[model samples]
Target: MTLRPIRLLAGAALSLALASCGTTYSMPGIADETNSRASTMFAEAKTAAPRSPISESAGVNRFARVARRIEPVARQLCETELAQGKAVDCDVKLELDREMQQRNAYFTYAEAGNRSPVIRFSVPLLQDTGNDDEVAFIMGHEYGHLIGRHIQKGQQQAIAGALILGVITAAASAQGGGYYDQTAVENSMELGAMVGQRAYSQTYELESDMLGTRISHAAGYDPVKGAQFFARDEAARSGGGQLSFWGTHPPDEKRMAMVLATMEQIQGQQALTRKASQ
Candidate 1:
């Protein structure tokens, strides 16, 4: 194939891949006022004294309480989205991770049996939370990942990226000779996949935060307080050098700003609803 055709094919593949990924809901824009407030909050959190870790029993109790409240609310939201014709799985299983030492939580599909979606919170991470609001927020955020179908979208992006890059590499190699360099094409595909996965990760995190805010608020938890968990200056990796919660959910002023903006938006929506009801 000619270079022009090869370029066109790669562009088409990339466009298709990108079309599959991204937030279904509108992401709130950060206003200047919200950004300033978030900056202040972030700065204050960095200087604030570290919260003492709770005992295992206390942690477990807090988790149970928060989970009890947040789960139903999250599920209801998921069901609503499904009813709106969103291709999302509303059935979510919340589980505690007893083995991992790192402070982290995640949502993923179970490897065995039916690929059921499960959200797991590590024991250490639970113990590290300052309050139930923090726990509720974290749980809500994980639920956002499910509602947003981020994992599924990410898989599509990776496949598209790999395909696009692989094709480009193969076509380039075939330009001089009729043969393509298999190893080079494979390497390019791997690189492209990594890029695709990482590219929208920050955006995904913010999207989750927005959804989490709504879920937590509906569940009667204070999302602003819950989001303070992100303000802390924590290490990205654990003692063993593995990626921890901070590694995945990096603390950022923009995230705090997004939360603030989302909360304002929610309040505005509530006011409108109340006015209409009256």
Candidate 2:
């Protein structure tokens, strides 16, 4: 009986997956960068809050530690996606910008032709978050981007958008037998870039969340508590648990639901494994 439901769900998912794969676009650039932006961030950034009472330094250190631990696990997760016996030849560098320049964390490929990934944390993010679990989840999510190569995919999408728009602009100019406005070409490229970056952005966020749930749990952190950070942030901003979609990110409530659902799936799998072992 249980197998019947599982099969039905799997079939439905496969059908949807097939339908979505009908159209495709490609990006034109090296998917990774070797440049390091850490120095600039450290040199010019400053914290937004006072340091004495909150011990912002300590918070920053803790953030670094959590990020360091999560990086290797994320790499291992990436490895699982590769063909048998393949490996990634790089380390993940964890850094913090104490200046609180932005309450954000992100992953990027190292410049200089090295594939080593870098994860940076903003001090304000560490200070603003309530606990280690939240930080871990956030780190894992960023790490997911690195492992999943979303940066490269995003660049590809952007380039494809620009090329398409450029072609259209050129064709239009040719039809008029006159020079295309330089400003018009630039504007089209900018618009294409904007669209490219945002294409399937919400889907990417959800994918990262799915990976983050597993990564955080594997690292011994509770994703449920980590997900509370979203709830808290939403409540603070909107004054209620209002659900609304944001560009480039899913709504807090939807993300929360994804996390919880992922947790449930993990638990279910573990239970099945245990039963089989008995």
Worst 10 residues of 2 by lDDT: 27-36
TM-score of 2: 0.69
Candidate 1: which pairs clash? Answer: none
Q: Candidate 2 — which pairs collide?
A: 27-156, 33-110, 34-110, 34-111, 34-112, 35-111, 46-99, 47-99
What does the lDDT come to for candidate 1? 0.85
Q: After TM-score superposition, what is the CA distance of residue 167 in candidate 2 from its true location, in Å?
A: 1.7
Misplaced by over 4 Å in model 2 are: 1-54, 84-90, 112-115, 175-183, 234-251
The weakest ten consecutive residues by lDDT in model 1 span 235-244
lDDT of 2 by residue, 138-177 (tens): 8887766765567766776676565555555655665677
TM-score of 1: 0.93
Q: 19-125, model 1: which lDDT tens digit per residue?
A: 97778789977789999999999888766666667899898899899999999999998999889998887888889999988889999999998888999999888
